[model samples]
Target: MTTRIDRASAGLPPAAPVRAVHLGLGGFHRSHQAWYTAASPEWGIAAYTFRNTELPRALEQQEGAYTLLVPGAPEATEAIGSISRAHPGADRASWSRDLACPDVAVLTLTVTEAAYAAPERDADSATGRLLAGLRERFRTSGAPIALVPCDNVPDNGAVLRSVLRAATRDDLRFSGWLEEQVSIASTVVDRITPAPTPRDVREVLDTTGLRDEAPVVAEPFSEWLISGDFPAGRPPWELRGARFVDDVGVYQQRKLWFLNGAHTLLAYAGLARGHRTVREAVGDDVLVEMVQAWWQTASRHIPIDAAELAEYRRRLIERFAAPGLRHELAQIAEGGSQKIPARWLPVLRAERAAGRLPEPLVRGLAAWVAHLRVGEVRDPRAAELVGSARAADPVRRTLSALGPDAGADDELVSAVGAELATLAKAGN
Candidate 1:
């Protein structure tokens, strides 16, 4: 007998005019960008999913209003109304139309890192889709726009620009327009949003007297550091704890090597230890020690002050152990092939070049090998990774799969092999 969440039921104001477009409309987008934009009532988002229509359909049914549950001693739940429209990825007409609109000042993306690797002409890829939208924008209004990539790739803004430039190299006029009219912004976004459980739905129904099919549950913590220009205009995201920095690289390095690196370790190591959620994994003393050790190795590379790094680590541990945030290891473990190179290899190579063997980093690599051996994790390169894991020289072959010259380092191979032996002996 609960009401469905909509503008009226949630007592929300009328939907704001759509001034932004978001691709990869998922849980993280709900908890992060959309939430930040909620503080700027004048700017609304036209959100589109990558592939699935289920979420978009459900959200559209609810009039793009959904509950955001922040679990704590006193849980906070609010109906988010920043999404003015929700459409499936197949709605290319709407996507192109929206991007072509002169009023749409910014476009944000949460598509995974893998999406960036797709050929720019591959219509199914995120970059391909973006290229198409930009073509539409260029042909129609030729209005300036900001492209903000919210994924975890390093120097995401530059990466996007590079890919788009390569894509449009054949068309000099369009290329010139791209360079002139588009501003690509790099960003560091943080929020731990777990997939909503049925229990969460029931809780939303009980507490708010509304059924929210698209509710997102997240930790109270959130951060967004952006670097670039918005020529057309943008929401005052800074007012909602987002920082506009001159350079996002340092902050990006801190987040990538610290928080995401630890999560990668926890994903592979914790899952091997039979822990499911991050909360469960972080509670284990063994996993906690491993995370601390990994953080120590990664911290050496980040340019942040030691005191601030220590505090960030402390806060990270607390966030990982936050109650009711059932952040799944399986979810994090899905893209090890893409993640390890970004999160671990930088620290590993740096430490190695310094004449130091990073044991914790190596151990995390071993855990990834072990996870691959089990053949449970989902990865775009799963078949190849599994083949390498089960190959004649698994340690070397697996390392080779991760990076071009990784296995060529005999010392690294020997160390990883030894660690793999230890894991096998422990039956992990």
Candidate 2:
């Protein structure tokens, strides 16, 4: 017999008042933020998808209750009851209303790096619509709210502020009000939640006996570090393993350079070696060596202590090698333009300044160039960069992706060129 998840069926209390509005209602948010908010049952979430209506509709159908499958030797399924409403990104009226509500103290976002692009002409963009919602709320409530961005970007709160300010350049009143009323909380979020496969859906049904249409699957590990002022109160997320600190910058950099940088290496270099998923790629000796080299370079720059960094890297290996998680290399490889500057180029520049070529970084850049050359990419800047990736001279092509300073540096250029040649010979 099949069961459905809801307040009545699950024997849980009714959904709480809408205290938080979440942008980008994807699997990561479900597994990470929603899971955290579940600890504070009084602070319900009204989540909106990023231009995707299917998840919104499906979650709404289930009364915002869905199975969260945590993968391990024996995967466990738990029904999450933190969401009060599910909405499509285009539902501007509802978004505005929710934001205007005085009780809605916090707005959390996971709308990826691309959504924050200063796209003024595109009114449908997440940034544009968020500006609209903020404008609407400012007029009605004049209330303080926290904007916690859970994207992978460094200083994400500041990034969100910059994007919103750019989007609202014409409206100084809205911009000023945003400065006065909104507090952007920078966050470092880590979780590996792959898009659910059909097998996962079947497994959820079999385990929970629930016909969940919008189930989310995640690895066993999750971490959240947040730092900022929240004038409007936030959920007691600290109770749920979230660290609220005075500074998230160090943690943010650690995550970006170590975890994210390693992922970028695996995505490009690992995929070049014909591995499709992070698990398979991470288990490879050569790929592991490449990641280790990159980590050695990255660790030199990140301010975390040696023991903590070592522990983090060790945990990363265990997490990445988890056989049940199928995090795709192609998925990680997406948005290389936005991702590389944050993940790799900084380490490359730091290493170069310290008089080191950084072999893993050079090869990673080469892998990205080769990956671009191999086929079509999904990046917004793909057309502009791919042609450059296929340029005749390796240095010229590498410079195009990395920029003019790296181009002007003789040592760095030579290393990049040599790596590109080596990769070419290897047929990557």
Candidate 3:
């Protein structure tokens, strides 16, 4: 019989003081940041689940300890004990109190790219809620703290600061305090943590001999590179293979243009070709060629050494082809409009400026447009853009979704149009 996991069952000491608060309490956090924090036994995380309350409820029931199932040559299950408490995302009182509490020194976020939209004024937005909490902290304790954004967006720290500044522009004192007291840290995070399957849940019981209602499954690989100061203090994350660097741009660009860009391409192009996961899509010759073309074009801009990039590419192939991961295309396909600007547009413009029409970039954009043309799009701007895709010419729709320059470039438009035609012929 499997025993339910809790602090008592696990024979844990009294919960550590909550020194860190995390937004978007999802699988990636369990596999990555929380795992890192678990290395620092003194620091406990008050993790808030995003949108849904079920995970938080389940985790709270388990006393914030759950199993982490890592699939590898020999799969392993380990209990993570970093989370001191789990709260619903809508717990404004708890969120505000945590931010103001002197003990909470770091605030980490994993809300995806879509949450940052119109962050300046939307008091109800994720960023807005963050600002509200920050305001409370400033008023109550005036404590120094770091806000780390662990998202795929480029220069995520800078982007978040700009949004916070815009949101607090009217209050000079608050904005001044923000610049003086807050540290916005950018990060590059990589880990393949798929949504837990029913099989995974049963396996947790069988393998760990514990009934963990909210167990997370991830691949063995994990990486985190952060750049910024932690003013108040921080968990000793470096002990857990996390790199604290002065500049994260190099690593950030490499991840965005390579891993994330390729994922986007596979999400659209691969799904358009009848494949459902990265593993299946990558096995196809056409998709492989498309990925290679994208990497070659994007490699021109990455500042890293060629040898390192090559190794990274090889590792990527192995990671993407990991059958156990089963990363869903539809999950990666979400927020295309928000994602494309960061993933594909920079390389597209750079290639255009260098006097070449990059075929892979064109195809990726066309695939996105084609994706919009077919099914219900899962994006904040979906209503406007999907209608535009249906109402306008294919090339025009591509340009409208991307930018004016894409429309003006005759060669680019022609290339994108050709890709659209090919996708149409494929009945995608």
Candidate 4:
């Protein structure tokens, strides 16, 4: 029998005080935020999942210690102990209590973009639960706290503030208190952490002689760019390579359009071409050309220097082609309704407004339409998207489903439709 991972068995130090609370605990959070926090042992995270209990339960069994496997020339693994407490979403009492504690200075979120769309009245949603916690904090200590959103949505800080304002509109007292006490911080986080497979667990036992049920496998690359106020104070995340900038908008766009947009394109176009993993798709000459063409159009809109952008793209191609990192196209393809608008449409709109129809972006959109017709779509708006795919005017209806502005673009609609026909003829 392998030795189970616990604080003592892993030779970890005493658990730090829970100075931060994180929602949507998952592989990305573990490999990114929690890993960064581990660099500062004084700041521990009390992590809660949105709905899943198995991850929390598994972490709880191991005293919130897990292995982070970074695969490279010589594979490296570390015991991440930044998460001091792991609680299921059902444990609302602990969540409220933790938030109310004056010592908990920051509340970080990794809930996907879809969670933000949950109805304001739905108290069970991620934002709803946050509102409840804020109310508890207001009623108790009324301490200033930062709300850091680490998702891929554009202007995520302002977006989250908007959602919270709408949720608390009727309650003037709570709303006022919220405005006075809360600071929403936007962040651009990047790390390629694939869902842990059983092989990861087995490898942990084989290499480290410790059985970690919740091991996370990630690429060697990781980045966290933060912009906002932490009135009550926060960890020295800067020591761990986190940059605190005045304007994260440019960086956000660079990430959203360059990194995430490419991923979305590869996910759809790659899958349509019968590729499974990012590595496999990026290796194909056809898919690589598609990606390069899309990058060319997207680069025109980004304000960054040309050399830097080229270097970024070069590094991205290397990262995408990282061997043994099974970043699945199907996994990246989830929630296209939320992702496409954020990732591709901005470039499409800008290119169209410039009197140039971007063929690569149009092809990417067409690939999405084709995928919706036959791929395994796991989106919050799946029914509507799949329905739109089957419509007589599929491209028009699909664009409409994405957003009103996209649907109204006559030139874009024609281009995407034409590309879809070509894709169908080519069996893509």
TM-score of each: 0.98, 0.94, 0.96, 0.97
C-alpha displacement of 378 in model 2, angstroms? 1.7
Give the alpha-carbon lDDT of every model.
Answer: 0.90, 0.85, 0.87, 0.90
Q: Per-residue lDDT tens digits of candidate 2, residues 45-66? A: 9999867899999888888998
Per-residue lDDT tens digits for candidate 4, residues 301-362, read: 98999999999999999999998688989999999999988898888888878889887788
Tell me, by TM-score, which candidate is best: 1
Q: Which structure is stronger by lDDT: 3 or 4?
A: 4
Pick the winner on TM-score between candidates 1 and 2. 1
Model 2: lDDT of residue 97: 96
The best-first sequence of candidates by TM-score reads 1, 4, 3, 2
Per-residue C-alpha lDDT of model 1 across residues 1-428, encoded as one tens digit per residue: 66789998999888899999999999999999999999988998999998889999999999899999886523578999999999999999999999999999999999887898655558789999998899999999999999999989999999999999888898999999999989999999999988999988887887788989999999999999999999999999988899998999988888888889899899998987889999999999999998898888887787789999999999999999988788999999898989888888888899889999888878888999999998486998898989889889999998998886788988999998999899899983
Report how far residue 303 has shifted in candidate 1, in Å: 1.7
Estimate, for each residue in 84-108, the C-alpha lDDT of model 3 and write its tens digit: 9999978989999999998899999
Candidate 2 vs candidate 4, TM-score winner: 4
lDDT: worst 10-residue window of model 1:
69-78
Q: List the residue pairs that clash in candidate 1.
A: none
What lDDT score goes with residue 99 in model 2?
Answer: 83
